[model samples]
Target: MSRKAHSFLHEYPRIRVDRFTESRERVPDFLLPPRCRAGAAKRQDEDEDDDEPGPWDDLDQDDESTLKANGGVRFFPAPTIQLLSHIHADHIEGLSAPLRSSAPIYCSAATKEMLMRLESQKSREKGACRVPMGEGARKRPYEWLRVTAKHAKAKKKFTGLAPAPRDLLHALPFNTPTELRYSPGVNIRITLLDANHMSGSTMFLIEGHRGAVLHMGDCRAETWWIEA
Candidate 1:
C-alpha cells in the first residue's frame, strides 16, 4: 500500500485515471481549529465542567466523510464528487453516495430550493423519475470525496495496481461560497462557478498540482456586450 501525503510537503504520487493509487494525507494540524476559537472562551468555560466532549475531540480522528457532513471542512482526495445542479440521472448518477450523517451538500441556495421543488413535483405526479413538462428536475448539490480502494484482484508482477470502486465522502451545504470550506494544506481546491443555463446551475473549477481543470455542468455561456 502507498503512504499518506504529508501537509504542505508533497509526497503522495499524483492520482489520475491512469495513475497509481495511494492513501490519503493526514489533515494538517494548523488548520484543524476554526477561526472563531478565541470568542468561544465563555462557551468553553461552560463546557469545561460538562461531561460531553468538545468538537476537537471528533476532529482529531481525521475522518473526511464525517467532517464534511457535520461541518464544511474535510481533507479529500482527487476526483471529488461535485453535484452541479438538479438534473437527470445522467448528470447525477455517477456522483458519490451519502457519507456520515448531517453532512452539508454544497450548492447554491437556489439549487437547494429547486431540488426540494423537484422532489415535491415527483411525489405529486407519482412520477417514477423525471417527468415530461417538468421544469428543472435538478436535485440538491453536494460535494463528495472519492477515496481509493484495492481492486478485486491484483497481478504479482506489476508494481502498479488498479483501484476498486471509489469510496465516497459526501458533503452537502445549504448555501454556496461562504458555506464552502476545506481542510488546509491539501493540494486540491474546489470552487463552484455559476452555470447560467438553469436557475441553479453551477460549474466547478478544480485546482491542484496536476493543473487547473474547469468542468462545465450544463452551462450555457452568455455573450455580454460592452459599449464604451
Candidate 2:
C-alpha cells in the first residue's frame, strides 16, 4: 500500500508534464537542480543493486539539456560572498582547495565542527601530524564565519581538530541582525533561523537595497524531535 501511494504521488506529476512546463516557463529566474542540466554525471555507481530509472527520466530532452549548469556554490564575479547552508557533502562538493582558500565561508558552528573533523581525519590518513597546532601551522582552508542561535549556549572548545586562524572564524549570534558593509554606506543585513533539518542547519534572510530573499537550506517542515 505504501509503495502504491508513493508511485501515485510520483507519477501523477509527470502525467501533467505540459502544465508543469508552462508553469516553469512563467518563472524565468528559477534555478534548476544540478542534475537537470546537460552533461551532469550520474551519481549512482554501477555496483549499486538498484536499477530503477528516476522519475525525471521522462522530461523533454531539450528542456532537460538547455539549462545553465551550476556548481555547489553559485559564483558572481563582483562583490560575491559565499554562504554555506549546511555541511552535507552534496552542498559542499565544489568547495575545492582553490575555492576554499579564496573566499570567506559563512556557516553554522555545528557545520564548521563537522568540516574540521572531516579535514582532520583526512590529514591523519595522509600521515600528517594529528596534534592540533597553532594558526600559522594548521589553519582552515578558508575564512569561516559561524552563525549560531541567540538563545544557544556557547560551544565547548574542541581540541581534536586542527586549529583555525583566530581571525578567520567569527561567530554571530542569531536574532541579532548583522550588516556586511561591502562599501562605504552600502551594506546587507542578514538574519539566521533554525532550519529544522539537522544539527546546525540554517535558513538565511538577506535584505539589501534590491530586495529581501530568504534562502532556506535543506529543511524539514516537521522537526525530527516532534512526535508524529
Candidate 3:
C-alpha cells in the first residue's frame, strides 16, 4: 500500500510516499452493523410513515462528520511533490497546517480553483473577507504559509499547477528534477508525471542511487499518457 524511494544511505535525505489509490474511483461505502440498520428502521417507523423518507435522510452523514472532525482526510504517506487531483475534503483535508509543514505541493488548475472555492465558502461562513491567492501556496493561511516559509528560509522552491500557459511564470516548473542535499554527499531527484485523474494530480518518478520509483496519486493505469 505504501512505497519509498531513497537515493543514498544517509540521515533523512528524502522519502516519498507513493500511490494513495490504484484508481480515482470511489472506495466502498462504509457499512454499518446490522444493529444500526435495525435501529434506523425503528426510528423511521416512529418518525414517519413507511412511505416517507427516514429521519436520517443520509446514511453517510456520520461518515462526513467523521471526516470533518478528523480534518476530512484519508491520509497516506506524504509525497515529495504532491499533485492534488481535486478539492474533495477526503482528498485534501490532510493538507492542513501540520501535514504541509513537510513538503512543497503541486496541483492542477481546476483543483486549485476548487480549493479556492471551498476556502471562499469557508470564509463567507466565518464572516471573513476573501483575500487574493499568492504566487504559490506560501501566501495561504497557517499551514500553507508556514510550509512556504520553511522552504523560503532554506532557499528551496515550491511549485504549483498553472491554470493556463500564461500562468507558467507563476507556477513551479513541471516535469523537472530538483537536487536536494539531504545530507553530506547525499542527494535526491524528484520528477513529476501528469496524472489525468484530476487537473493537477501527478505521478512521481523518483530516481536515486538506491533505485527508481513511480508513484501515481490517483491515476488511470490505461491512460494514453502512460504510453506517451
Candidate closest to the true structure, highest lDDT: 2
RMSD of 2: 16.2
What lDDT tens digits, residue by residue, belong to model 2 across residues 11-124? 211111001011121111112244433344656544342344433332333422234443222221222244566666655543433333333456677766766545434445
Better of 1 and 2 by TM-score: 2
Per-candidate count of clashing residue pairs (backbone under 3 Å): 11, 0, 2
RMSD (Å) per prediction: 18.4, 16.2, 17.5
Model 1, C-alpha of 182: deviation from truth (Å): 7.9
By TM-score, rank the candidates, best first: 2, 3, 1
Could you tell me how far off, in angstroms, the CA of residue 118 lies in candidate 3 after the best superposition? 4.5
Error of 1 at 191 (Å): 2.5
Kindly list the per-residue Cα lDDT of model 1 for residues 58-82, writing each as its tens digit: 2335354665563534442442223
Candidate 3 per-residue lDDT over residues 60-83, each given as its tens digit: 234646556644332222223334
- Candidate 3 residue 78 Cα shift, in angstroms, is 11
Better of 2 and 3 by TM-score: 2
Please identify model 2 stretches exceeding 4 Å from their true place: 1-75, 100-103, 120-169, 223-228
Among these predictions, the greatest TM-score belongs to 2
Candidate 3: residue 173 Cα off by (Å): 2.5
